[model samples]
Target: MKTALIALTTATFVGTAAFAAVADLDSDGDGVVSFTEMLASYPTLTEEGFSAIDTNGDGVVDEEEMTAATEGGLIPEA
Candidate 1:
């Protein structure tokens, strides 16, 4: 029974993490995600919204930022 409880807890944690990661991608907490939606969620984003998504500020949002935006959450990951 202890083992089963542990397993259940572990699964719940993993599921929560996964959901959070995906939620990060949804800047507005909406089901859909898009560059426009991201910009709208973060009004402070500069006219060039891409730059804001580029957390590294490398002038480009590499896989990391893309993942953060689409799966890991928003660039800022707030």
Candidate 2:
């Protein structure tokens, strides 16, 4: 499953019309969402959008940023 997402890492991306939970996408249980991890939930999320959601530019999206993205109309709400 993860490999499939990785294969599409550089593919065209956009927002999906579904709600994605951080817990569900945190496949490694690392407390932060990596690009591949996010792909599972947001199959069409672009690298640029992920960068925006990451906020700190740490290559990972934390809970606070996820909330902000959804609230700010960047990502769809649950």
Candidate 3:
């Protein structure tokens, strides 16, 4: 049971790490990343680039969008 618990804890961290890029960007912990938040990590980011990452054009980037952009090489992994 102890070993299983350890494994579960590690697994959870590893999974969360997949979104570590946004984790650092979303300073408000609102579960969504905004343009200003993205700029902090990607200094060279432009409005066009941000729009591309925003995907749904909702004016914010979420975990799924962050993952896609990273996996697609649109943004660097954090």
- Per-model C-alpha lDDT, please? 0.55, 0.70, 0.80
Per-residue CA lDDT of model 3 for 1-78, tens digit only, reads 999999999866755764786788889999888988887878788889889888999999887887777666777433
Q: Where is the poorest 10-residue window by lDDT in model 1?
A: 69-78
TM-score of each: 0.38, 0.67, 0.71
In model 2, residue pairs whose N, Cα or C atoms come closer than 3 Å (at least 3 residues apart or on different chains), thus clashing, are 14-44
Per TM-score, the best of the predicted structures is: 3
Error of 1 at 8 (Å): 0.5
Q: What is residue 67's positional error in candidate 3, in angstroms?
A: 0.5
Compare candidates 1 and 3 on lDDT and give the better one: 3
lDDT string, candidate 2, 1-78, tens digits = 998897666332212212245666789998778989888767788899888888899998777777767667776332
How do these models rank on lDDT, best leading? 3, 2, 1
Instruction: Kindly indicate the candidate among 2 and 3 with the higher lDDT.
Output: 3
Pairs with backbone N, CA or C atoms under 3 Å apart (clashes), candidate 3: none
Where model 2 places Cα greater than 4 Å from the true spot, the runs are: 1-20, 76-78
Number of the top-ranking candidate, with lDDT as the measure: 3
Candidate 3 lDDT score at position 65: 86
